[model samples]
Target: MKLSSLRFFKEIVFAACLAVLAVGESPAKVLTPDFVDLAEKLKPTVVNISTTKTLTPQFRMRRQPSPFPDPFQDFFEHFFEEMPRRPQRERSLGSGFIISKQGFIITNNHVIAGADEIKVRLSDGREFKAEVKGSDEKLDLALIKIDAKENLPVAELGDSAQIKVGEWVMAIGNPFGLAQTVTAGIVSATGRVIGSGPYDDFIQTDASINPGNSGGPLFNAEGKVIGINTAIVAGGQGIGFAIPVNMAKDVLPQLEEKGKVTRGWLGVTMQPMSPELAKSFGLEGEKGALITDVVKDGPAANAGLRSGDIILEFDGKKINEMSELPRLVAAEPIGKAVKIKVLREGKPREFTVSVGRLAESGDENNQKTAGDAFGLSARELTKDLAARLGLKESRGVVVTGVKQGSIAELGGFQSGDIILEIGDKAVATVMDYEKLIKEYGKGDVVRFLLRRGDSNYYLALRIE
Candidate 1:
């Protein structure tokens, strides 16, 4: 109970308390000063977009009588009679950023897709009626213009190509109709393909992007717009996708001048170069798209490109995967001759191809018939069959039927599949396939190149 002892106990208690507090608190991340300032400056440029769409309902008519007695039957029929549903008006909310002081804004195509009226509200409580100037559904991008007399704050679009993973980013949007909601996170990855579209090079981030965040601006550290918030993985947390600003910049001129997107076509069907395929071809690395079938008389065909060639580069840009090829070719100007490098028989070759406008129906096809040696029945592909199969050229023989429990069926051969090649030799007719089959004796395994729908793969079938 002495004064000296009491003071020592109090000091000990204070030291224990400090130790507990230190363990509970972790080191905080030091944010750059620009983050807060950039977000505040960019807020005015981001706007909330509301769209209204009127949809009409379609009703089906019933002519069959009701199963009931006379008077009751008439009442039942009346009750069951198909009544036309009234038209309904749907309202949706999204977000966008002004690209120009003249009231030009950029957003997602789906935001104003079928809207009859679009209203844009700014942070300053000002509202304006907007009209869609252009949109590209493939890229899911839209450009709209509003007649605003007031000078609007514009957000600068930055180079997304220069952005690196783990860099800080911010997303500003009207998530769930909550206007001007801001979320911050780091770039988790780049060039992500979620299979949402053909050109699906998305910037994946951990930003808290939810419903209604689509069409918003994803800002870089400099407060510049680097991406357009587009999608999020369903039922996933901390996963969101944005369209890179570079892609938007490349297609902006086409959208502004043509009101739609036009892409250059090489007229070739391709698949990713798998490790097995790469090893078979004696390649050191797998980094290109394997050409499955080439469209006859198409740009690639005219340029001397053939099936089984692996496209290494397009227009001097290295193609790392099969998906990258489509985006690269699409971005090229139509009719422009571009240099393409391909690996054929393990040797690299370069060619200059005059790019052609991509046709909506561009797909490759081939045909031939086996002589019952493999228990498979097939016939040469005709123009009609090719068209029905959505094929560009009639080159392969279509499998008519595969005998059950037979070698062909056991080898995964199916009806409606076109056989393009037999052991590196192209099969263009029934005789070609029959001659190839005759060359194979009993118990001999041969690799067959087959086309099913738009995809191509090689299968090995052993002759019985």
Candidate 2:
């Protein structure tokens, strides 16, 4: 090789090395976010929340007799009975971030639920009494307000829909009562449904979120709040979950205006579309929610949606999974007519249905009773019937009749058996039983807790 060619080759390699170094430096700066400055700016927006709940103790009758003699026993019994049982106060700590200069804050509903008094403490050593403006138990979110009487430092809300996994994030909360604690880690995952609730779109992160971190702010690299730290896996390290800020933002207006969330209801019970079920439906792949049942006269039913229909899209959004449909349906405005694309018997169809408001409590009148499906007739347990059944309390539904050779009879259900619970949820009324029973579909094995002759026993019945 010539000397001039060798020198030119060496110079080219050196220039390429310099170009690589320049490209790497920019991403290194982007990846290693300045947490110290971010923490200082966000600390004022985050606040410590302390709640006090008054719990009244229930007195249970003593079952065993005193070990002492009659006179000593009588004296001890009277003395203990006369003693006053005072109401107990429980104190809990959580974290919240100011969203508005008018003192509005966002936190998890579990934090301030049943709290008789709530106190908010700012990082500047100021304290104020807070009140719950609105709460949604289904979403586990609460909007609270404090009368600071001045403009407060508010956190910048970011679009969580743009958040991707492996992005650097920071959490600011009062974990374990440690106020203004900051933790940083990358987003572990997104759209995680850990069975938290119907809308279980949580942003999973490795940020250290502890007991008292509920309702804190999860920030992006730009110091904008993207999530609300809400839950953590028990005994698991670097596993935490946060509510997406976009969801919170959607609920905030309703919470601030109505003091409760009124979600749009589709009045349909659905299950995940499995590959086998998809094949049975003549679908190439499992990409839609399979409707198990539709409430009679419901918005869906009125729109001609049937039990066998497969929901492919709702309001223009593609329904890729069963879990996505509920969140999408709930977000729609009530009374607004929206297009629903469904596959019925392997044929495409569309329907325009007006969304209905979901009742906060399950409305039994609107729900389909479980009698026809289960082949059992049940009546609400009245006080008179409770006495007849030798029950101390009038609760649950008493089985009035059972069909011959039906699933109920096969499951050992008798006429006098009281249905206490269905599928692990307590059935205090016939409505509760009906609403819960409708959640299961064909081929699903459902467990029922029955109180038969002063004893409780669970019965497993497969729906055929």
Candidate 3:
């Protein structure tokens, strides 16, 4: 063969090898996704929310010089019922997402909390008046409906329970009134509790969530919303919190059906079982919810659950943390029987408890009442009082009024505190408390066990 022919053959072989290497080797790295297409597809589902609130003037605007003299000014001010008083209308802006093609939108409860009128604007520049369907302040979630007279785009809610930390997530909202803004970041953390409420399982992320982003949706890579951007820590950069979509899914149906969420009540206040508490209780592991108080005649009480019992498991699920118990109990079916395992008196015990529907907390009087001997007025802790004070049970006498500068007030006794015990003796009734106090005279130091807002502590008072 000629030299030219041999060279052409080598070139052909090299070209073939290059084609095979190209098939085996991967392409250049794309650090991030091309969010342009995804943003365009998701923007239509996101909406901008503007609300108007009506406020009445607290002080009358300076009155113009009246024709009458100053002596008649007092009479005119009191008698003028229909003065030209201007009612102030305050406007606020936020973000929301369409959950249904029929115009059902979801946003933060705070956004539309006191709004007299709520308006929703779409990416297409169309606006519509929205009606609040339901709201849950505890979760900071609200659902509103709008009549756009056309088929609207809907965003799918993803299973937030399956989301992992460091996963890429997108937040779409009207941040700082800039409508339909999109920001991306990875999930910085999960199950974060920033002291918002009892159900404070927030997904912490680095996404730029601002004031208007309160109601916006946090989406996964698949374009599905896994969380709702609800809060941002002040003076922090790239630190934001979102309510997991799984939590919202749990209460959304109830909100839509009953206009409120009905949580299952175990009637027991609880705290984390610390390592020290676990060792003291003869437990091997630092896992369980330490029961502080048991509501009298409530589900737990009727089930033989006591205040000192440490809950290890509920409804076949393990209670690894204190916060886990609330979410588990709240997810329980109302009126359904569930098995609860507890460690009482350093022994494992189990009981079957019937869940009860949570009732609304009522207002209690905040004035001083009776007990001049102790410089405090006390009453039986009623169910309403327990609910109002966030107590687990109505098992003891509650301090209704604490006289200032008195021994009770000086000893740190406050109104709404439930007196559980006096120096190792249980005081369930007002008579019991009075009798216990009668045993302690002046110059005596009495230790009182008290329950206040889901916490239990002992206070010592030196009788004067």
Candidate 4:
């Protein structure tokens, strides 16, 4: 009797221990949604915006009389007052979302660029006129406010920087003016540069975003706002770009505080050093922006940045590529002193730079040009390069061949024309031209200078 009871008790104890172990050692959980409750709760804040602007059209003078006598017609013309303005309403559509319980909205700048009237429609079909809070053309971001009361639904914010490729994402917007269209896809890429802005670090997604989706929210699967839908490649599908919310966090506060953004500037035109340039510079790694021009009285110039200096880091952020420096410098707090690392003459040099506020207008840098003639190409002449090119003064590049559609003819370059330097640089040679074409590449300008038969000319060329 004692052995049977003891065995039964032992078996029961073993079974209980196994049950506890099973509960504690379960497999890792899946990242899928446990419920769609969060998404359902946040959908109400999404909005559609319709804007209209009134334009006065120009009218031509009447060719023939209105069946009136000559004296009468002349009197009517002379006696009549100025013609009344004819109002023509032009309409545009875009998307927006409520960021505040009190009805603050966010969208792209282009959405309301010339809008005279803005109407925001909520998910409940309620429409309200929105007033502009702030807008920035540099980053294409806008914040608008609408009057509303009571507690409202707000989408949660997620760390877009923490998201990775292949993670699921969703977008809700008025694509092509169609209200509340939902698209789903994975994060195709991160930190995409589509020539959008100086601080363009876009999240590439397959989610379909049309013209009207400019200000829509790119939501994570958690129903949180991670990015702002901003652009779509025209004539392309499954290609869309969103501004990462993480990058917006700092700018958002400034936008809300002063209705504008104040960024730091080093006053330099920089370019990524190619493999050839890197070898010539004796750089061990292809890292850092090659300073081409340092603005007079700019932070960089004050900090001792010089042409051919390769900036390697700022504030301890390892700058592996040249593209990272512009936004990094601009994002810094103005008037703050920062440390900059550079590679000069095959050695590392560090400098302390007092950061300066970025001027909204005017050229950021200036470099003397060297106009010269090489084997096949002629370039801008500066004291430095002119010494190399046997020239005495600064001028533009000279073209010997007007190749068909090969940067020359397409640029309207004549056989003997000189090409003055365009953006970032004053006058340019093939090297400067290549550096410039590869640098400050956020725009469509590919300007040049031309000298034809002893006459100087300036030409606007498109960088294809």
Candidate 5:
């Protein structure tokens, strides 16, 4: 080999060895958080809550005829009807965290709902009686107070909006009657809806939460309270949900002052936009909420929002999902004017609407039958029928019955479903439904807007 070539080969070997040394010196560090200090620092802020409820049993008069005749039967029935029933006591356990030095604490509304008595136990083993100051059933949040006579340790509140997926979180609670248990895990997801209620934004974590852990605190790495442990999936391991601290913070003042929550109402029944519905409306993608029904003289109607308009934005926030709009609207101040952007006839339009207070009521009625083509029978909705069916408006045809193994059944149609619109046109009566059904022939696809229970959605049916 030539001398110069030998020299060049040595230089290359030296460079490769240097590269290997550099790589060996800089390996990534896997950090495992030591939660002992964090847990100890925050445990004093957490409390174990126990609730007691009294259930009174009622005796009812029996209508059945007794074997004894006349006077004897009447005497026996009177004796049984006048018998005194015992009042049973029900006890439940939960957890909470102190929020203020003035003895204010935050817990789940369900934890102390209908509770006749409540007790709180601190980490120092001191116990005190608690009284519910205020509660909001919609948000499932409760504010309670205790006369501790001394300053209490309070947990620092953190911004849940800053929380990222895969971040370390610690949950401290009394799970299954065990007090002051600490569990650690990472955030699995955010903004999860488990069909719990209308505003169901939950933080998903793998932190072991159980029955007794309800109303506990979920702490971030800095030992700040980020979420309130609220729910768990039945029979599912490592899946627990917490209410974001931000949402709780938003209503805490109202709960403390009013003892209830007052939400703003948009007065529109909406359904999620699907790709098929978007295409039918000449849109390329499904990114907005489709209005099924607008309450007459309500906020949306007053703002000129009509059925078939797709809501693109509420206030200043873009609505990416149908569920987001309700939460956004509910959080707005009542009587406040807000801008709503919508797509109408493939064109973008905006409206300013004054929000109204939500007034919830229930009832719905219906009769006439059109069956055979769709394998379902439907009738015109009447005001009396609407009230009976728990509907607020009488503006649709109600499904009377569905055929077995038919298109209606296969398409998730059930008896008692209110058909609000057929093929983007409102079906106010059985005559309207019949007229719309005739417009679509065999092989044509049609979309039906329906209200089942408190939810609204679209179902597509293809003519045979």
Candidate 6:
């Protein structure tokens, strides 16, 4: 064969090799979405909830004059009952999702609080009147129900207990009344508390949740609902928190079964006893909630529990701190017999106690009541502070020193204030208060009904 013919054959082979290589190489990454489908699928179920609450005429306007202007004060209050001297219309917006086919939806309680009318607008442009099924302000969660002739789209609930930090997540809500807006980000953290309440184990995310996004769905990458957006810490952008679906699950059963939550009470005030206090009492580990006071006839009392006793275990789980007790106990059923382990005076002891139902606290006398003790230095309420606060208590205990702005101070208790009760019982004597304080190895709260002069006050001071 000729040299030119041989060269032509080699060129053809090289060209074929290049063609095969091109075919084998993977294409540059293009969007083959996992989230786009999620957005489309979940958007329909996410709804806009608008609440109309009537506020007193006084509440609508600032009692303290606005620093900026007062041009509308006189004209605003006159002729317009809506102006807020008597009654006025107050409206707000939030986000929600249909959790059931029968129009069961979920949102934040603050969204619909005091709302005389709740209107829910769907992704399909249809609107319906929604009724609040139940709400728990302690958790900042609420369940709403609407009338729908058809089965509504329900988002899938995922196990939040399985969620991890830094996982990709999506938030769907009505941001600033823009319904069904979707933002994407990763989970920033978990188990965060923003002074919302006890049991605040939140899933933090960088999703763009704004003013109207409260009570919306925070979905995992697999399109499962893992959390419900509740709040954003102030001065924080790209930071928001959601109630873990697991916590939401705990409240849903009660909301569906009963219109309100019924929590179990041990009638004990408690707190996380510091390592110093724990060591002084001979506690083995630094963990466990310290019982400040066990109520008379309360489940804990019947079980031989006492103040200064460190609760190590409830049922089968170990108690790590005093704040952990309420979330655990409230999860228990009333009247249920359960095992409780405590470290008494440095020794571990165990017992069984029947839980008790909690009832409304405080009464008309504005007399002191609730909790078990006030750890601060206190004395019998005198006529001086009573006259100053405009309260009428003569025998109630007065707070002399709040330990230099401790939890009591932050709880709105001042020096010279009066205390009324522990948990639910009245404290008429320092012995009564001491007994209550002794029951708690740590301090959770000292419920007080106070008299300052002509005024009576109810204050819950967090001891833990």
The TM-score values for the models, in the order shown, are: 0.67, 0.75, 0.69, 0.69, 0.70, 0.68
Tell me how many clashing residue pairs each candidate has. 8, 0, 1, 15, 13, 39
Off by over 4 Å in 4: 1-39, 56-87, 361-464
Tell me model 4's lDDT, rounded to 2 decimals: 0.73
Best-fitting candidate, scored by TM-score: 2
User: How do the residues 61-140 of candidate 4 rate in per-residue lDDT, one tens digit apiece?
Assistant: 33321223465555565543366757789999999888889888889888997789999999888888999888776788
Please give the CA lDDT of all the candidate structures. 0.82, 0.86, 0.83, 0.73, 0.84, 0.75
Clashes of 1: 8
Which regions of candidate 6 deviate over 4 angstroms? 1-33, 59-84, 360-464
Q: Candidate 2: TM-score?
A: 0.75
lDDT of 1 by residue, 1-464 (tens): 69999999999999999987886685232444366787789999999999999976433222222234365655654654556568789999999999999998999998999899999999988899999888987789999989998778999999999989988899999999998999999999998866455687889999899989999999988888999998876666898999999999998887778777788888886766778999998777889988877777989999999998999989889988888999989878889999999899989899999998874312343222244667788765655345434556676678866764577776678777888999999988765777688688878898889877677888887776
Model 5 Cα lDDT, one tens digit per residue, 1-464: 69999999999999999988887785432355669999879999999999999986534343332234576656775786788888899999999999999999999999999899999999999999999999877688899999999999999999999999998999999999999999999999999875455687889999899999999999988889999999886666898999999999998888888877778888887777888999999876888999877777888999999999999988889988887998899889999999999999999999999999875322121111234577898766555345444556575678866775678777778877888899889988665787688788899888988887777788888979
lDDT of 3 by residue, 280-340 (tens): 9999998989987677788999999988899999999998888788888888889999999
Winner by lDDT between candidate 6 and candidate 3:
3
List clashing residue pairs in candidate 1: 363-392, 366-395, 366-396, 367-395, 367-396, 367-397, 368-396, 368-397
Error of 5 at 175 (Å): 0.9
Candidate 3: pairs in clash: 295-393
Task: Give lDDT for model 2.
Answer: 0.86
Candidate achieving the largest lDDT: 2
What does the lDDT read for residue 245 in candidate 4? 85
What local lDDT does model 6 show for residue 66? 26
Model 6: lDDT of residue 239: 80
**Where is the poorest 10-residue window by lDDT in model 1?**
360-369
Candidates, ranked, lDDT: 2, 5, 3, 1, 6, 4
